[model samples]
Target: MAEIIGVIEQLWRYPVKSTGGERLDSVEVDERGLAGDRLYAVRDGSGRFGSGKNTRRFRRMDGLLRLSSRLGHRLDGPELFDPLGRPVADPDAFLRAYLQRPDVALAREDAVSHLDQLPVSVLTTATLDWVRRAAPSAVVDERRFRPNILLRTPPDTPPFVEDGWFGREARGSARSGARLTFVRASERCAMTTVAQPGLPHAPEILKAIAQAHDGRLDALAEIAMPGRLGVGDTLSLV
Candidate 1:
């Protein structure tokens, strides 16, 4: 039997790839992911997917941008905001501020006509510990695997156990509930190898997780429904 352990504390969503993300007090989850999460992404002139993945070829996407649901909408069309919360009237202008090289800028200007959207991504503390233990030397920070939900669980549990939480709803004090379904454990990628502040040596961490888990240790969960989640939310394994 699975056990109820902890509650969610922080919730985040990155509207754009590689750029910073927006923190939320509460978020509604639908099949895709946290509402307003990854609803848009920048595309290259060729209509191919573009982001930090190809930022070098499109440097203008280097600067920070944000995405959020419009006041009366359900995340079908989110709004873009600068890191300061100011509105960005022109997408081209926003791209220009971040893209530095002329060739990359024009390529982005031509290729990235709009933002790309992805399904939601979730994470938890238990998963982090598993990664830490497996790779004691790697720096595993949240930034490496940007997720929509950051759940706080018991100290010693495995990280991706939430994947086994399918058919269970994590209930909270207010009528907020999160239905968990075990998606396949996320696969590690070069992105996990990037060095960031807090995590100076990331490759080692990725290596540890991969070694411990047979080369499959990217911790992410897919949510069936999104609702308000709080610190003390009851994790009902049913």
Candidate 2:
């Protein structure tokens, strides 16, 4: 007997890999996961994926976070936005200016979703509250974790419930037939520490995740049954 664990509070789609995402009130999910998530990515002149992290010489990782990507009504169309949330005419120029890197360009990879991990990343407010208890000082915004689904768990539900959801299936609300299978706990990296829009530079956030949360903060999932998912949708273990 699967139980109603929580309601979906938010839905996020990242049109570009690792850039700011567009939050949605509702979305249609398919085998490829969210329709327009991570369909585009920054590629250097040589075609190497431009990503944050100084460790990867070919990737311009951090500055991309400063830009935000939104999907137009057409699932394939993505509009770039500046740090101030204004649509940019010359997105490439805006990116170059923000990143301070030349020869960088946005490229679309139709074959690949350009996802960092699995297709769906899920987390709960309960677990977030636990992190708040652990960190005490840092802001624990869900955006920092970049979860596609943000759930509001029932009171008394323990933190880290997602850790135990591995290999299990979860159904979305709205009677939409959506389903997802928990894959693995999402691992922490330098991206969590980098400053993004509305968030300041604070590497301590990662420290909190590592020291108290075992360096894992979210659960990655694969689509089980694709359907429309909306905010306030119930997510029940199935």
Q: Pick the candidate with the highest lDDT.
A: 2
Lowest lDDT 10-residue stretch of candidate 2: 52-61
lDDT tens digits, residue span 1-238, model 2:
8888789999999898778998899899999888888888887776667666532323656677888899856665679988788999987887787777788778887554466668998889999888777766676688888889999998988888888889989897657789998899988887877788788776787887888777998789999989989998998887
Q: lDDT value for candidate 2?
A: 0.82
lDDT of residue 226 for candidate 2: 94
Question: lDDT scores for all predictions?
Answer: 0.54, 0.82
Give the per-residue lDDT digits (tens) of candidate 1, residues 1-238.
5456567667776554455566777766766666655445555454444454453333233333232223223444445565556666765455655554222221222333332223544467878767767766676666667766667777777666756654444444448755655445566665566544344546676667667675554334456565656444655554
List residue ranges in candidate 2 displaced over 4 A. Answer: 54-58
TM-score against native, each model: 0.67, 0.93
User: Could you tell me how far off, in angstroms, the CA of residue 238 lies in candidate 2 after the best superposition?
Assistant: 1.4
Cα TM-score of candidate 1: 0.67
